[model samples]
Target: MRRPTSGCSTGSRRPWNGLGLLLVLLLAGCGGDGGRQTPPPEVGVPPSLREDAGPPVQVVRLDERQAAELSVRTARVRAALAPYTLSLPGEVLPAPDHYAVVSAPISGRVARIYAHEGEAVRPGQVLLELESLEFANLAADYLQARADATYLEERVARLRTLVEKQISPRSTLDKAEADLARARAGVGAAFARLKALGLSDATIEGWSSTDRERPLLPVTAPIGGVIDQHRVDLGRSVTAYDEMLTLIDPARVLVRGFVPPEEAAFVQVGDTVEVGPRSASAHPLTGRIATINPALDEANRAVVVNALMPTREGWPRPGQTVNLRIRTGTPRPVIAVPLAAVTYDGEQPVVFVRTAPATFEKRPITLERIGPEEAVVTAGLADGEEVAVSQVFSLKALSRFEQYAEE
Candidate 1:
């Protein structure tokens, strides 16, 4: 009985004790029910690792009331021709033929000023009068020469008649003819001198030997313009060729743009250019390049480009600094939007594209060029898409906030 059959014996098995029964129960529990496998311990997984996770949300939603409060306005992206532009500093100048410097034709004292600075004058209008002794001498000489010519002409006529009538010697007639020629030459020389002193041919033709009035030289305007500078006062003594007044026609102007030497190749004669004041609010004037200096400026090494301005009233006065935008390359078709519709995200330009009435997708864009009114988008945008032109900053803020909230 002590060596009795064990629980594991192949013969008749003995009934198990309490300890053996407990061990069997423990082993059965470890093996699971009916030899079925017991699963491993459960583990927690991140939401990102889940098979059902969706892509990141890139859209920003707004209610009608919110959008209205922000004054959000949208514009459709448009296909347009965008030309490359080069910006340069420029100066407003008087057109070459429309400007003049009035100077003294003879040494004289300024007797009168008919046109003051800033006064507009017409062509051939007397701008000033000069009192000079030299003019008096010239007038006297001219009168004397005319008198001698008349006297010699009468003598020649009388002598020719006498010689033809055989009442005077041929030698005497010849001598009289030579004297008349000399007198005519003297007259011509004196007339030239009077004309050189700024006297018109009409005035010279009208002068007589009997007239004793003091000769006054009238300085006339060669062009129609406003007197921009007056350097002489009444009774001021000036010499020949001395500058007395400066005149400029503001209606006809030129914008001279100074371009960098490297950029000169893109500019050519007849290219359209826009000129305006330095203030952004000023309306720009359009013109075509009239000339491009082949040589660079020695001082600044900049190429000089000139554009003739169309006649306009009261703008772009001479000596005024201006802004010049030269359209360089040929324009190409591109998708464009208002400048206000674009915003920056950490230096990355982005635009909010309206996918629905209340939803916008923030999309990055590749800008080919940005102009004063619009930006040319080379990539990441399509024509006919609507973008928020107003309140873009608000949309950017909302996008950032939503992004953080999602994180």
Candidate 2:
């Protein structure tokens, strides 16, 4: 057997069976490169452990068509003298001296109403007429006192003549004089009472005892205004000092602005203010701050600032809600941008700055103040830089998507 032909002979020719071939492959894999030792399969770096990498810059690139489809608009940043403005909630109100409460001067029943609610009235315009027995009695007393005064005067003159002709004693003339003086005082007292009852001197002077018509107390407007409220109707009874009508002069109106207590110090009398309806599209009226209340409103803890402005017909009617923009300080040069150009990212205010024709870079900024239409930039922007004023939301979305793709 040729030394049993060495069952494990280094074969001159041996066919590789399936099991032998598999064993050879296993040995070669375990030994690897004949002890030259392959580098541990070149371990890859994880994303978290990658070196020399930073957060991707937020940027959005679009073609002209995409921008146009989004209605993107741009405005250039500029150094402008934008006055600091404080916006406040406000109400349209009648000026203090231009508003009045018409009240009954005497206890009476409403005989007639001449002015209706919302009717315009002028000073001295009769608003209503009241039928009062008390007024009639007053008229009667005045007439009687006047008649007595006339009789006493005639008696005094007759007595004077009689005394001068020696037909009457001098004592008689003196007694007549005393009576005339008393009667004159009574007449004066009655006249004062009539005057106190809202009767003008001319009105009293025109009245005569022979007139059989009953006297009606006329209630007149003391100021030019619109009748805002009517509290009495025909035949309604009212007492003295009872409110019967409310009048407000719409032409002389005020904007009562409620400013936050923290910002009160920035407001001053004589500062320019713009008052308008709460709607932004409505035209605004310019005015100056006339007064500021020393105390805060108890309900809202806000300082009350009154602005005096010229009136426009049918606008800014009393009790209408309004917006007040108070220019607190003089205009100073600052980097400014339109309010539409600003947006927020996780509470961080940001703006889309146009770096190229269709490229925008999201930039964080610090704001000194923000007004209704514009904002003052304190940092992160330069004068003459352009920013996206419209379609900023679409740009922000694109920026976020780009960041995701880069990651």
Candidate 3:
């Protein structure tokens, strides 16, 4: 048997049985199992290494697939020359020294009204006539005082002559002189009273000795202006406190502008202003700033600015409303964007700036001024950067979503 012929197999070896071959394969598979054993725990790393990475960054990185689902759009920001001016609503007012109210100076019956409503009058022109029993009594007292004054003067002269001629005693002459002086003082007091009743010195001095006429007290205009109103009619009884007339000189018209406090700093006493009537067809009136009130209006919270405007044939009346355009300075270059591009993030003003393709970042900006359709950016943005114009809120939403996911 030679021990199965040492290195060679005999034909009767049965070609290595199938069970034995299968056992060999199984052994080979088991030999490599130790090599596949899980990497011995990454040497020096902690088990919670990934957990210690902290929260995800605030950046939103969207691939093309993410942006395709939204209707977001953007615009390139560029430098612009924005106007530096303010438009405000204003009203026409009577100038400070040109408005007047006429009131009854004394209790009287209206005898005649010479100045009618809407009539123009000059200073010292007769406005109306009043007849009063108080005035008649005053006139009578004045005339009587004058007569007594003259008679006492004659009596004083006669007494002096009598004393000088030794016909009357010195005591009697002194009494006569005292009575004459008293009479003269009374006459002076009566004249002063007449003057207080609005009588001119010329009228008082021109009175005739035989004139016993009941006086008609004339009310005269205090200034040259149009008669805006007349309250009294013929025979209408009025008291001293009644307002009988109103006068306003259109030549002294002022445009009173109520500007918001934000723009008040630009207004001064010499700024130019253009004012237009409420009607679109009327021409605009131009003027210069006459005053800028230091205090704000308590009712509207606005700074009051006044412009001295020409009368312009009195087309713009007092208390008439108007529109004002105040030119502050010349236009200059600035960085601005469309007003629609800006939105608020809480109380902070926010804008979305495009950083890369289909990528945006929410940015806070400082606005210098806001025009009708544009906003001037003072900081936090530069020219040539693209900004989201439409559907910017969508970008904000994505940022919010990423925030919630991290939480």
Candidate 4:
């Protein structure tokens, strides 16, 4: 063995050189040969076997490395911030400018109907034809009284001519004048009677020449809109107390939001609000608030707010229910992060903010509700900080469900 010392020395030096190279690689972890990644120790690898073995077995802190990788992804969350809140219940109703109920002015049987349900009507348009014996009788009396006045005037003129020629007494001419005045007075009384019965001046004048048109409807719609409800059909008589038809204009719609009494306290007459159709998936239709009810509903403990929607085509119709969100104040710039940025760690909400390219620190925060898409941070955050806004559950699962077993 002493004679072969150089050869033995060379063999021993070769293994030590490889071991030294491996130690450097394991420490730096990159730009190294893939000869062997030391097999991590199996569970229950006894401490007594370590020195006798050729190479020591190793252990990896897998959970610590996994948590770090997950934290890196959570640092990208960004969004608009809002205050914490609860969504209050609400309903859709007709706009005040567009809704109207047509009713009869007087009791009468409807003879003909011009406007049907879903029909559009204008102001002063005739809606129906009515027939009433009371109206017809009044017309007949006026006609007869007019005929009497015409006959009396002729006789009065002849008698006055005779008296003027000394063929009749002065008392006789005065008596003829009195008789004519009485007939004229009767005509005036009858004309006044028809005027009080809702006979338009045009219709009244038309009645004398044409006997065909009679007992017309009151035509009482003062505003224009579409008919929603029909109370009477042809040949059905209705009264003034009965609602004949309901009309609504689409352009003048108002949105009603039933908000909690506490939330409503911050609402003002000019606050902004958003209205969307029942099927609106994400985006909301916008509008300004027109009114806020000061009193709360005793039954629901909520205050009613009316938001005025402008005339926008393809918007929801009147009485069409929708989702409403009332913005209580102006939007101010604040640190806004996605809902996914903050994650629950069993009982506490925590977020991982990026401290370096590969390093992150976990921070806990209190959440505030904005609208549907974003959340505002009430505490534990600053504006424009890089926080994880993605893959929250993955972070929690890796930290909890994927914990490494102790060797």
lDDT of all predictions: 0.85, 0.86, 0.81, 0.67
Clashing pairs in 4: 74-388, 75-387, 75-388, 84-369, 98-249
Candidate 4 local lDDT, 21-101, one digit each (tens): 999878776544455578888797666576665422222223456755654454444334344333445667788777887
lDDT of 4: 0.67
By summed lDDT, the worst window of 10 consecutive residues in model 1 runs over: 7-16
Which stretches of candidate 3 lie above 4 Å from their native place?
1-83, 151-188, 279-283, 329-363, 371-407
lDDT of 1 by residue, 254-318 (tens): 88899887557657798989988897835689889999988988877899999999655688788
* RMSD each, Å: 13.4, 13.8, 13.6, 23.8
Clashes of each: 0, 0, 0, 5
Which residue ranges in model 1 land beyond 4 Å of their true spot?
1-82, 330-407
lDDT of 2 by residue, 1-407 (tens): 35666676646336556568889899998788677855677777875567866433588889778867886789888787665788789988788888999999999999988999989999999999999999899889999999999999999989889999999999989988998999999899999998987778999989998998867999999999899999888999999999999999887787899988766766889998998878794568998998999999988789999887778886878878998888875245788788889999888789999898888999999987677778778898999999999888889999888888887
Residue 215 lDDT (model 1): 78
TM-score of each: 0.62, 0.61, 0.62, 0.53
At residue 165, give the lDDT of candidate 3.
94
Residue range 1-407, candidate 3, lDDT tens digits: 35666346554455666668888899888988856767566566653467667433345567777778765788888776655567788988888788888888778999988989889999989999899888777777887888988888898899899989999999997888888898889889989988876678888877766876667888888889999988889999998769999999888688889988876765677778888876663568888888899999888899999898887777678889988888764245677888889998787677888897777888888987776667788787888998889877777788889888866
Give the lowest summed-lDDT range of ten residues in model 4. Answer: 54-63
Residue 35, candidate 1: C-alpha displacement in angstroms: 69
Q: Which candidate is the best by lDDT?
A: 2
